[model samples]
Target chain A: MLDFSLNKIFVEGNTDQKMIATILEIHYNISFPYNGLALEDCIINCNGWQGLFKQVALKEIYRIESSGKNLIIFDADNTSNLGGYTKRKKEIEVGFAELIKATKKNINYSIYLLPNDSDNGDLESFYMSCIKPDKRFFIECWNNLYGCLQSKNEARYELKIPKSAGMVYSYVDLFENYRTGFYQNKKTKRDYSDDGLWEYNFEENNHLKSLCKFLEDNLNLKSN
Target chain B: MPDQSEFITHFEVSNFKKFDHLVVNDIGQFNLITGDNNVGKTSLLEALSLNLKSNNDLVFKFHSLLCDQHIHHHAENKYSKNPIIPKFNYFNLLKNKEELPLTLVFNSQKVILTDIDYFRLKEEDKDLFVSTPYFMDGIEYKYWIRIDKSNVKPEIQFMYEDDYYREDRKFESKLYKPIVKFRNFYERDLNKFIKELSQIELLNLTAFDYEEIVSIIKIVIIPDIIAINIQKINNDSDEMIFIATKSSKGLFVNVTRFGDGVQKIIRYLIEVYYAKKNGFNYFLIDEIDTGIHFSRLKIFWKEFLMLATKLNIQIFATTHSQECIEAYAQALEELGMEEKGRLIEMEEHNGKVYASTLSYENIKAGLISNTNLRGA
Candidate 1:
């Protein structure tokens, strides 16, 4: 059986790539090689959905699927704030129908939506699902603080969630958000040391457990 | 010359050079042979050339196979150097078994070469010999076997069979013309076959080929060169030279004066032009991108692929450069000839040479990922 680390994770951009790598390493203790993943090994940073689709149109997906399992994780940016989950899910399904059809039916591959399969939001929302229930008060305080800051800010664009879900992740158990800046660069910096190894159980965390299951089942990964 | 393209669609070589046996089938119009050093890449080209054409061309390639210019000199004879030469038996796959004949199969035609004792040089009425200097003990005289442009004959053993004109009932036997070749610098008298082609009216180039060469040269070799002129050298022998017209300088310069890179570019271009014009079916080029720059390789391949396809020329070229392979793949993709271009990789396994054709997917992926296909 192939190692879990060999299973390729095709994601939107550098931020998702780093977040996924961090998640796998910190939580699952799986390490990736220097070069981005291919059949031989390395993470494939598709840059974005358009770039990822181009690779698919070029028949690269068939090549990947032939050699090993491919885990395609894209941002389901259809958050409840913008539109209802039901409407957004339909739009995503329709938009990606061609891709889903092109993929070989027998291949061991899966496409997972963020937060929940049918739910809106993205990797950020999914991280929010991993938050401890005890940190509910802190989440409320952070949302209020973000809302106040958003009103005062001159920047025109709306941040889907007022506060970064990654930033909120730092306050919870088993999560350490070391990432900072607009695009993960060191310019706008935040450094937080892990208090200790959180007493987190793999089976207890449903969101993370599902991701591990997908990796295990699709990749035929022999758990270490 | 035959009307239809006599380009070799397939060939099998055995007991020739390093390759004990190699059979390449489903060959494309353009075949690129590549591998590590001493992998029989050049020998494959030689095998193809010999398979497709006359014996005279094979003699020239055999001499310059290694391109080593080691001519032993003596204190007595100052003019020509004594070079150690090998006979036909030296080509046997198993060196100890000299009786085994080197076999070359082209399409359906098979040509078997035997002992060099059958061949002898004739200069006018006198018999030429390769004279060797006396070491300390004794003197030995030999036939002066010049690699190219030699009047060597096979002691008139039997009637010659003309493979091309075999169908024609008028002529009792068919006469064979040499296949086109653009060899590296080591091969002496590069114009021997080209000069012969020029002598034959039907096989000679048309004005259109000259125009095409001019146009191709503008993109491939020297941008400054406007035209090419085949001028007769004012020497005792009938020797022709190529003069490149410098457009900006408004003057013509001998092609020999150009650097190896420019000469290498022009060499293949000339072969391509001749093949296009005279309907020469096959061309064998060794180290096609020897002196050319890495960046210019793509430009060279683009022009080569387009011209070779347009002229229906079957090209078998060998290269040891990674850039050349990538450039070829890129050119094929750009020209929409990815299916037509074939990269034959040669490797030695268990004392025998093995050849495998790289698939389109492999070639494309290798190039995209910067994978080394040369297998060095």
Candidate 2:
């Protein structure tokens, strides 16, 4: 039913959708369609990366390109076995190159790998980069504690940067309940919510500039 | 009368072939069954066909299947006897007992095959039995048959408690015959079923508009086939042949000779067309993706979904191909029918077949994650 009349930004999952939606809203004051604000504008989270590679999604991308631009963002998922970041990113690009060319005559579309800086990381890495500077001290304390936990059990802290950053920005409730020391917290555990991080200083966040430009160009193209 | 519009929502097959007790539930309008080879996928389709109990066609079809397997075994071993026995191998019943009936239940309606009878001639009756001449000398065929031998018919009892039909109705009266006569509930239309199998010409069925027939077939078949029509060769009334014209060359070709893939496509199109036209409750197909190219499978499924949706007919198809299974998942999303499809994977655990019904969401997830739902 979504004929993609509105510029469609396809993401991997809800986390990416919500994060990008929040960014679009806070930075550019552009409310997403699913938020009961922008009925004619939104992000299309296809649930997982495979959905983007599916023929159904490919067909949808073509239809969306007819009247609007379609932006596809995927987690590089560049683990070590997949030949690391550069090769993995090239693989994805080459895989979709033919399909992209097939639809280019009728529609404009762009592919943006997550992290926006390198081809090797995921949305978690991007989220890590965009963490509010005000929470730096709490994050440092959390990292020190995570290091001690890792020294006790290395496997527990695998992929340290993303996981550590996740704890800082996502699990803010745990930090808020901390008593006096870093490891001392009340008997309370809560889910991660990305609501506050949307209002971070996007104007100075160089990591988000290309993505912002894509969204701005899409919006301008839609209005014209 | 069971609601003529109401289709089989679920089925439970017991003591049928390898399935001791296989129950498949949450059957949607479109279903793609996938599993390992010996997991009873074809048996599942046979069970559904038995539930329909359309006519004596199935009895003959089953006999042919058994005979083919038997003949192939002897043919493989040159030292085996030349006189091949033309006896119907007793149907496989649960616990290997002859009296145990193979039961097929479609919703609440049941078709039970009971009273096992095999045609065996007595010593005296054997003298009266004559060997029919084999016109082809290369193949030797021998069988025991008495001219006065009683037709060994399997006693099929259709038992249902639905009050919608007349209580005093005779099962014999509703028995499906080998002629094209439209009937509603409690009847199997064998001719209608055969018409679909032989690839019925769309022109013969006057119920459909000529333009509508061409358009639907165009979508159903390969892109090269631009149009379909029936040609009555030499003004002969019974000599109508299905024909298709290539888009680029305008060269017409007989539909049957157009390779298995095209024939399959045409067969499916005709089945859907007639099912809709005649208000058939269900369309049963085994290995729906057979002979279809992997790339064309998506096209086949997309067209199938469109036609089935238009007709409002429920389909039960079995497949072993992962491409076939994934095609359904892809079609559901493409057509925005994310909730209208279901994938049931059959498995054999401890010598008993069990069906694990997967919803569209589950199938999508399984496919994306590359999980082997098709079984080991």
Candidate 3:
């Protein structure tokens, strides 16, 4: 059973859980299971934004309150119908405040919206930003294809792929050694972090820096 | 809002088994309790049964039921040969073996139980004790055991309101009898089966009641079950329940030979029908989905809710199955009787038990989002 009474991280999906676990293991020396793919002991995948709030409403926040440190990570998901970063952060604040009041317990928790705390995007956007500078042309190529498809009729472009996911997967596919078949079927987009495909330079990338600092401040980890 | 006619609108338990202090408010007509192991789902039911009425016979019956459960749990292990001997301690009923009284409140009425050392009775009280026999005096007290050198036999004193109803005094209350059923798949005794059959027969169920029960059984369990009948093989033998199925070609199969699911359905429906006929408004079932198949859960819940509504009985049932919980939510929605049901989740935190009453909307949202509502 996953212990909720631990300094915990609640994310939006399995990809976010794995990605955050990978980043923590690489930079913070915090080891997680399954080569950082499975973090069931600590990181919880809430399935979606609504699920995160559902967990809060179910008194999961009270369980985390015992540990005294908690972190929630989700997408800003700025769409035509949905709210952006400010609105998402406000939702988290209101939810936590109401739960804290109802439960009568003060919880030390932080909300970090993806890609950065202020950005109107998702985990994939952060992954796109962390792509190697040399592999930027693959993302441009996918964007060009996406733009052409967008200009055509909706029926002609029936394959409605998400832009950020397409860009990140395209960049990672560049490292695929198809001729030798060495990394042919073994590597998936989920293994990008473990395969050392993405840049994790905290000094250079501000987004990665902000996330690392957020973890440092929130989690009770050994300082390097 | 809870119906004013409900038997118990609010319930609170303190210093009882596994609950330091727990309160469940807004008691609905049909309550499905879900929790992790040892979180006091069954304990809540036991607490409610203890205070369901002011009758001393009911109290003794509850104690015997607990003793039976304890004996059954241990009968398979080291006590298999000595199954008649009880290995459970009634003192363990108190939380942490403290002397604090077990307090239970049903709505505004409070029932407090305190264990008094039998040897501590005064000389004048000793005569009262001799004249006042324990409710189980006819049968051997299964839980009456001497512990340690002082001959410490625990005696229970029930205090309701401000009056103490000692063992000698008979409790007189107009409270309706609450039917309590536990999951006892091992109850294959011929006499007990006959007793249940006799009880159902005494209910004087009309043809319509029998038809409703048989149709529900057919819908939720065996589709071929045409009717249920009680038959005696000969004058020398006792009566037994038999199931007449469409495929049996007029042959009646003894109910004892049927599967556990069939037997459980028969037992449950009979109890509910008997309770309704007897003017009982409360029905408590522990492990309500014990023998029923997972696929039939939704229909069983639908029928259960419909019956409870029609009978105007409040039902408290405990379950550990997530499928059962989901089926209950689906049944409530399908019947549009969401307001009549509540999913109670009992959880223990910091050594104190708490019950969170989830409405239909809350339960639906949790199920849709795949939340761990059963505490798993």
Candidate 4:
């Protein structure tokens, strides 16, 4: 097993990681070793509704040398104050620039953040357009499951979930399931014979091609 | 041949575009303007181009496309409360030994000059002497001339306009014709300019059209490289594959397959060649480093200096690369232009754009550990 270097690619999830791995395998014929220091790695941390932003920040700067290239992809918050996000990026950059040398070679990290003022939606919309709209059935189901979690309802874990909901997650479960069972065809949907509900666990879809495709398209992995 | 005295001597615009004021103190044989992006550097060049076109009727074809320039006015009328109202004012370019005052206050929304807009000298009001010669040409080298025969000079003066076509209805008729009315002024050899313009070539690939220069390049086969066949379709705009590699390992990618640095270098080559061939005498390129690579900056500047000196094609370009300054210094030394070639640096101070010369000596000073060359 070639240990893939943890490059900190800033992609969506494990599904994206596997799809990228498959692409490298079939196209470049190189197998990626996950978390092995010799092989490059990219650990993607999210800046979504749940502010898990701190997770992607500090330690990942070192992973840049492990990967062939490191790219940080971020989406702007189109909420109200555009400058506020810029300030946030500036804060983080200033916070990070202090650590790295002011040269190109140190990290070779290029940050790409899409502007929020677009009349159209963000990268999610772009991903949705590439696949069927109802394909995010797993995300819908995950959010549905979180919406019902009693701990999520009483305005409890305000520090964890979105400002509105509070939910503590340990398994990185949302991303794992999002990668595996994002799409549902009639047959996959009809597999709800046990409880009239099809709950997809990440390890369960190890052989499904649709799961891989969903990850590749969403994370902008090299499809060739 | 027109007398040197009769030619447009000089011009300096104040409150024009990003330039609030510029003296242009002494016009040199060659001028090269280099600075960061959007620093009012191009704005100055555009002002000069506009001034030049206003003065000369040399080889400008914009006169033939008047209808196209005004079409935007009709489109703009959709949102504006006013119905395509035109505006005009004189910069009073010509000034006698005394100080010449120029203001950009809105004179009128009228389209044509209609004789009511001249400075109106009656041999009593006391002051009227302004000759600001400029050439304002849009991309593709389109230039136009602005003239007013009814002025106190009684004789008309044509100043060249740049980047944009003048929408003034009064000067529209004068856009055509040579410098000296029915007979052209300088008797510039058309064949000479055309011969120069034609020698230039480019990758010439347009997103919408695949039939340009890209269609004519002769393909060669090389060993060990994909047979050198390229597939450039509109469908694969986002997909960039390495088409060509180093000559040692010749690959087959389309011209667009290269990095922006190589692409811009190719583009600048075409422009330089075109300018050198035709006695364009002057070039104004904005955003000189939009897609240019720092590594290739030396080659680009060297090639430009060589061609500029050989063809006597004076150029003015805006750049955001400090490397460009270094290259300019080296280029000056290479072209033996240490004494000539004006290098002007522009800066935006408190919302206003101003310029100062980045002298050859100053460039030398900065090369040795100084970061504050702006002061120099």
Clashes of each: 11, 2, 0, 59
lDDT against true structure, model 2: 0.54
* Tens digit per residue, CA lDDT, model 2, B33-53: 777888888777766654333
Residue-wise C-alpha lDDT for candidate 2, range A44-71, written one tens digit per residue:
5566565654423333322433445667
Score each candidate by Cα lDDT.
Answer: 0.54, 0.54, 0.65, 0.38
Candidate 3 residue-wise lDDT, A1-224, digit = tens: 22334466888876787788778777767666533323553676677776665452344423543545668888887864386899988988898798667656676678999888987988887887787676667667877887887677477658665556666666566665522223436444356563446677678898888888887767644434
Compared with the true structure, what per-residue lDDT tens digits does model 4 show for residues B1-376?
1222222223356544455555443234445555445666655654544322222232232222223334112212423222222222122333231223322111111111122233342321111212212223332221122233335553222223322223332232224221111111111322222222322222222342222112211111111232222243356332222334455256455544444444444344444444433334555666565555565555556656665565565566665566766776777777777766545655454565545444454455434322333211
TM-score of chain B of each: 0.67, 0.65, 0.74, 0.49
Off by over 4 Å in 4: A1-224, B1-11, B26-38, B51-72, B75-254, B276-279, B350-352, B369-371, B374-376
Q: Return the TM-score for candidate 2, rounded to 2 decimals.
A: 0.48
- Give the TM-scores of the predictions, in the order they appear: 0.52, 0.48, 0.74, 0.35
Which residue pairs collide in model 3, if any?
A: none
What are the per-residue Cα lDDT tens digits for candidate 4 across A1-224? 22223234453333333333443455335554433321222334343412222232222222333433444444434443342346545644664475354222254344433322223223332222222234456446555665666355556554343421111121222333434443455333212111112222323332223333433443444434
Give DockQ: model 3: 0.14
Root mean square deviation (Cα) for candidate 4: 22.5
Pairs with backbone N, CA or C atoms under 3 Å apart (clashes), candidate 2: B1-B164, B1-B165
Ranking by lDDT: 3, 1, 2, 4
lDDT of model 3 at residue A9? Answer: 80
